[model samples]
Target: MQVELGQKIIDKIKADSLSPKPRWHFLVREWLVWMMGALALIVGAASVSVMRYLAENSSWAVQAPYGQTFAGWLLLSLPYFWLFLLGLFLWLFYYNLKHTKRGYRYPMIYVAGIALFGSILLGLAFYTLGVGSAIDGVLGRKAPLYAHVFNPHIDFWSAPEEGRLAGLVVAHVEGEDTFRLIDRKRGEWIVTYNPRDDIFVVVGQPLRAMGTISGEQSFEAVRIMRMRPGREYFQRFGPTVISVSGSGMHRNK
Candidate 1:
């Protein structure tokens, strides 16, 4: 009876033309899974770092005058793009890890926990290396909408009509009180100020003006809050990450 059953199994295999897949095929598939999972984990780490960068650099102390509650500003200032990337990569990591050999043996909680821990660990390391600011700058330059959407510096200064205008100081005279500024809205203005206002204007500085519009393209700045000098915005976001517009400084005679 055993012989007959074995013969029947052999006959079924012959009839179906069944054959084993090459061992190398399985190896390649497993390798691919590992590669994808690793890449996903790396990207997730980057997202976390950028999130940290935004949280650290945002002007949380100044939102009160804008009538924005802490929760409201917090929501607006979030890096939505990075948040999306993190979620997408985390899912990818989990999916690829689950498909790996013996991976099914682990519980979902275990797999997710691994992803979370790895992101936190690598994210801190990347932040230490300044990857967060670098990536944010690149994205801000290449994708201008990146600033329009989630940049806290840009969002906070968007209320120009409310006497809040912010931009990079594109041009200024040596030892002079007047300077030319290009704001985030791509509006260039001639800014007149008083030196005794304790305001020092310099080229390539991100500045917030507390004044009212005086002309079609002019501003009479009462006092300017000058942030640490940074690279030009709109064209290129620098350490300050304030997006604005304008080019080539013209000496207004």
Candidate 2:
């Protein structure tokens, strides 16, 4: 009885193998797999671009002049949409590849690893090409969420009475130790510098000044430094940092 059962199973397999398969079936499957891969790569790079954009524009660059912690910086990056999208695309990549021929031979972990690695490599290339900045510019102009989600909370930085102000320096006040500073919210402040510190103020530079709010739109800066981009962003949004309340400010005296 066992021998008969085995012979019957072998004969059925042979019969199935001899059946003609539709030529278009394989072609369609291959096409779908390729399409999914292409899409996965696109979204993967887009995710990286989002991170790069936020890193460039975050307030930490303006406030923290010195070094910052990596883990802290990573925590601040949560609100941005890219990190979520990256994970989503990676999963999609794994799903698409799994349906392809021979894909089942590899474990899910292997597939996911390959997807993540490919995405990261593609993402870096997109960031280097300024794809992230271009996307941000578009979103900033068209999407209100751009400001709502990614922008740093301003009430903390607007503490003019606490001797701190954040903004872009739009102009110099003649030969005086002052320049026009525009905060992320577009609020303008008069930033005065300590003459002895030799702090340089250039027009249109992003800056954070520490002192007191002298007027409705004025702030006095006792110290200043050229803002470095990525670190400042992490400082502003990082987890341990509840508010950007001059936590990174330095005194020149």
Clashes of each: 0, 8
Off by over 4 Å in 1: 1-9, 12-18, 150-153, 192-202, 205-233, 236-253
Flag clash pairs in model 2.
60-232, 60-233, 61-232, 61-233, 163-211, 167-182, 167-183, 168-182
1-253 per-residue lDDT for model 2 (tens digits): 9999999988998988766579898989888997997798789877776676556534555445424355554455444456678888888888888878877899988888888878878887888897775676565445554444544333334456666565555555445766656565556566768875335565544555566767777676776655433223322222221111123322221
Report the Cα lDDT for residue 11, model 1.
97
Model 1, position 95, has a per-residue lDDT of 97
Q: What's the lDDT for residue 216 in model 1?
A: 78
Q: Give the TM-score of candidate 2.
A: 0.62
Whole-model lDDT, model 1: 0.73
lDDT of 2: 0.61
- Superposed on all Cα atoms, the candidates' RMSDs to the truth, in angstroms, are 5.6, 10.5
